[model samples]
Target chain A: MNHLFFQINPLEGFFFGSGKAMVVAGVAIIILIGLGLWLFRMESRLQRLNDALDQRLNDAQNQPS
Target chain B: MIQRSWKIGGLALLGYVLCMIFFVPLGPGLLEFTSTGSAGHVQDQDRKVTVYALTGFGTHWTESPDQLTVVLRHGTQLASLPLIETLDATHVLVGMDLPYTVPSKSWDVLVTHPVDGTLLLENGVFLQDRFIDEQTKWANPEIAEYPAELPFHFPYQPQILETIRNLMLHVPMWFTMFLLMGISFVASIRQLSTAHDLHQDTKAEASVQIGLLFGALGLVTGSLWARYTWGAWWVDDPQLNGALVTVLVYAGYLVLRATIQNIRLRARLSSVYNLFAFVILIILLMVLPRFSESLHPGKGGNPGFNSYDLDSSLRAVFYPAVLGWMMLGTWMYHVRLKASSIERKLRQLQ
Candidate 1:
């Protein structure tokens, strides 16, 4: 077998496996989630502002004028 | 109200479950194999390959002139495997493909020093998808005409398997998004004919939101698929290009509404524009496929859902997935509409 001068190379198995795809999907998930959270916080802040304005308007209207 | 809420909630729950279902058994082989030429099976005649020596694995020579390196691996551990060919000073040449009928569910192979019986190489696997393969015998001077392309190899790629998961997550999102957009398109038509401002607004807002969602999901899912299948995040496939352009057009619809102050004109224009969009959507997605080519299935490539694309295991989840996602999208539209109108009133008050 030594005199024959043989060569054996292994096969390359997988290229562009799903790992990279998952990473992209993960990023998209994070982005969507962050946007959702920001929308929620914005809604809360707007509600607070609306409430304060209503309170101020009520006070002015109730003033003895 | 409670009943409606329950219905919507139920629908949403179903959609979430559907999206989350990669758990269902996707056919037999947990480690699926696909090959070049003959798929997973090896052919006769072209047998024998040269590769880096596995110092101590069992080597099997097939009658078909194919070389096979059988690594009897069990789970994650690499144990000792029988090696028929003796490893000389020149390094061992194990065949690239071998037939193994595993009666059990596990096995391993390892390299050890025969003298001290010490294990030298325990287990370290590095198998990349190489461009030039054993079939390139013709390219070499000595064996340029060697007709042996043994062991048509496919990998137990987790990503490809995970891509099978896309049958659940990715497809449903687009389906749901499209459903939402279609609803918005219909509403826009009614609003246009009736001149009901509320209906018009609903149509406009819903279309924009759902269209945006579809665009975003399509972009994200597609990028993920490309990363795995095509080895790129984006490609210039005609179908994808059309989809992307359509998405941008819808986005422009939003921007168009925002910039214009004339309420009536914006409403009217956007409605008409949406109708045009629906037309373009059909043309780009369905009609043009007769003339163009696309890698995506529905567009042009292997166009129908058959055994190759949608197997029975896939159908079990896939059909339900569409229904679930559509219901969820409708619920999202309603909830989002309530929120949108409330915000609008608030803005007017301010």
Candidate 2:
């Protein structure tokens, strides 16, 4: 267990060897992913809201008023 | 026209900051030193010791070998060592004659060059005392005067090294988060004043959402920085814990908003809760950290990067990065607010 804990995987080794510049890359990637997820959630919410609005409009048109 | 300019300006400024962060080179710094015969430790009996040094970027040691000089400093006393050889641009050998009795056991190394300025390695060499003599006289050499005009470069910190570039990224995230949270706080106040205006409530909610996102990014970047610098991903630090708690508290505000069924009651309750959360944010992030012991810089009586670490070169990019990030975060909050308004309109139609 101790040996395993001390052993650095290839990915970790690459980051460590590169003067931890990859850590900065990792941070930038995380921010990009976060922003992307937020945008996607907004898109889906808008889609759902548009569908609801369309359904209401169709129901109003069908009714004899 | 004015509104469009800010967005364009923000993008431009961030692009400039990104370019500068990557392109700017670090100043000269001493990495490590070694003695040819005895390993860095000198005894009073030893007459001469030749010390070899390895330096990080911008040294240019071989260019003007005549101007380069090495000195050992113990408190106020200084002794200039002879530069024996300049091996390369980044390596040099200096010879030091051991004094019979010195003022101190620990000695600081200062390598000075006109072009590179002065690079210091604190407690670089240690002396093993054969006898402690109180009346021994020490030579005091004058410190080198740096030229008025020096090349523009980031300050090379021994520990931080290249990862210092993260300053532009990590620090700006918190600044952006703070600006968004401030917007949320103001909107919440307006929400309470204006007789359950759902628009104001939506504004508060949207800003909090964006603020939380920026706060999470700050935590992640800070954790990575801490992992490299402090040798731990997470430490029991006051400033760090305070920031984490502030993020969690804002998260609690979102959870509270979801639980309430009636729209009017929800707005009222959440607005009041937002006020409390904002207060908690200020206390946890700004006030408490200052009073307690913390590993994070600028907290717990620790002199912040502003005092010595943040040189003029760093400030050139850092201020613009903060402003750019805040503008981007505000733009995101506006987008979130617009979507929320459209959603509200659709729900009202139903």
Candidate 3:
């Protein structure tokens, strides 16, 4: 059609209409990234807990039972 | 042994989901098309109407213009129009020689391709004339049937289109969330019966934490999907509101656990709250939505995964996606449970 320009209107080009697939993919990626951060935090917490447990065990042994 | 089984099962199902989701090609079908003039309207005089076609695949119409024919069909009646000339991979221009007036009603397009073997696009073309009901006399009562042995793929719904692919990601998140919350509910019941056992409390907490993660993912994905399809990020639909409320209730459960000073009291109180929240979660997500009107399909007397929306082709990948996500959530819960147990042992050493 004569009047049909490229339908890119602002950010709608990236998120709306046929661009919906990209939006969904972005959401999936964000979820994975969030989970990755959660895992990293959990690992750090576990490491600290393990270190505390080891220190307590060592302290009890040094105190002669 | 149980931990090893969990790891193996979770990994296997996740792999299955990844393989099936990416490897399966989208089915070939007409997505949409619009002419320079309004759809379904016949011009009073002769004019050049440029047809723009949006097909899933370009291979169907890559052939020379002579090989493909665009025909208008109404009931048993059929009229073949001339292709005005320009032919691209997915578009065509048809010069209409309207000898007689075609009344206003929805018309179908039959694209006869040498390779595609008479591919049909229902409601493909519309011819709107002033005389509305007069066109029914020329209507074709015969329905066009698709080839039975087509490859496995999701159906192309008008509003959803390519976003139908999100069905695998978004819907499965909610399903998995519900599953994890269900596990948490069971664990809470066990904790109460066992007089707030530490292990059961840890398991319940882990399940709820992972379940909340999945629930949050579902909400974000659903919101984005609604933005494109329903023209808004959030709507006042019962199913959506119910999900938001359920997640908030679970958040309160976490807050309650954190505030209580005594371990046993925290376990007992949180377990009771979790039981209440799970009941509300079920009522909000499942029961209440069904009883009220909602835009979400399969809810409020809407036809859901019936013979229509979720066709056999979709069910192939959908079932595995649901299973894979549920298993993955369980794996996350197991990891959290392991961490909690390690913390408890550390406390004992202290």
Candidate 4:
């Protein structure tokens, strides 16, 4: 884990001094992360809905109505 | 098919914008020009003065020194100066002969290159004058024309530099947020008119959720950009404060909804609150920013990129970016609305 962290040092220097290009990269990354979180939240909601419907279906079948 | 096309189209447009943002180069700009000696000023009696200039981004001064045209501009008059030497691609030594009389003490330096177009340093040199002369003849009079058919490139802004490309990402976030908020506002109005229709309420809630996401992203990105350019993570600008407050107000709408136990009451009360929130949003974002001094472009005393800064090159990618982000936001709202409707139906069934 320590070695893995050190690998980023070279890249960090380039990004930090690259005529403020790092700022653009930062903006793009923030957007990607935000959208990715929303996607995951949507997925989890659908998952919960699926589980609830399946449970209800099981209950209805067992009742023999 | 149409539904799928829009989603795919929006993604493709954003992909195109992403490619252009990183690859498109920035044009050259004059960063600083200073007199080589004697307190960085030229006296009226001084016949010859040497000046050194430092340029930023895409400048090729040494490639063809002869192609470079240096001029001192005072008001409408342009007096051409000879380029004494090219130290490197970014540094140049220029010799200027002091005119006997001039319109004003302040002179703007214009360096026109065949490749870099025309780079200007405002008030590049100052002259020590005993008296002001309104009528003066320029020794070397030449009008510089910017080269035609230059390649597509973002205009080099001194403070912005390469980060100027953030215009594509940062600006579109707010545009997308506005679109979602507008949708939510309309849905809230419909919910109120229909006497608290649950479906309309769901639509309003979903749109606000997505709008808030975009608004949060906008603030974060704007803050990062400000940190790099303005040397601060957060400034007390009206536009920035207004955006933060608007996002918080919508967040309050969510909290208000979550607190209410009764479904009908929640819909009715939140719809009324949404109306007021949108009005506050308009006043803070559009009206107040213009009235007060703001560091953000297009507000207060600052002229926006629209007046001149946003060139054809930027407009090419920027418009597509705004459209793409709007489409993506609408798609997210659609997903949220569908999920919420399903959850509500399941609750009712139980």
Q: Each model's TM-score?
A: 0.54, 0.82, 0.73, 0.82
lDDT of 1 by residue, A1-65 (tens): 21221122111112122234345445655654464455445555655665766676677668967
Better of 1 and 3 by TM-score: 3
Decoy 3 TM-score against native: 0.73
Candidate 3: tens digits of C-alpha lDDT, residues B91-205: 5666544335665467777766654546567888666532455444453333344352345655545566546767887988998988898898998889999983588988999
Per-residue C-alpha lDDT of model 4 across residues B63-103, encoded as one tens digit per residue: 77788888878877787766666777777776656556677
In candidate 4, what are the lDDT values of residues A1-65, reduced to their tens digit? 11211232333235534556546655765675576457657756786886778688688778976
RMSD of 1: 14.2
Regions more than 4 Å wrong, model 4: A1-13, A16-65, B38-48, B54-56, B128-140, B148-150, B300-307
Tens-place lDDT digits, model 2, residues B1-350: 79667766776677677667756766677776666664332334354564655443546777778888788887787888776667777777766565666777778988888777788899988776435565666767777657424567788776676678889989999889889989999988998898846899999999999999999999999999888778899999878888899999999999999999998888889999999998998888878877877777775553235556677889999999999888878878887887887778777766
Give the range of the ten consecutive residues with the poorest summed lDDT in model 4 chain B.
Answer: B38-47
Report model 1's TM-score to 2 decimal places.
0.54
True contacts kept of each: 0.03, 0.05, 0.19, 0.11
lDDT of 1 at B50: 29
Report, for all candidates in order, the number of backbone clashes: 21, 0, 10, 0
Measured with C-alpha atoms, the lDDT of residue B194 in candidate 2 is 89
- CA lDDT of each prediction against the hidden true structure: 0.50, 0.76, 0.69, 0.77
Tens digits of per-residue lDDT for model 1 on B170-232?
A: 766766666766776887787688764655665567657865786688679878877766778
Error of 1 at A34 (Å): 13
lDDT of 3 at B293: 77
List candidate 3 segments past 4 Å from native.
A1-65, B1-6, B19-23, B31-59, B64-86, B95-104, B108-128, B134-136, B139-144, B148-152, B302-307
Instruction: List the candidate numbers ranked by DockQ, top first.
Output: 3, 4, 2, 1
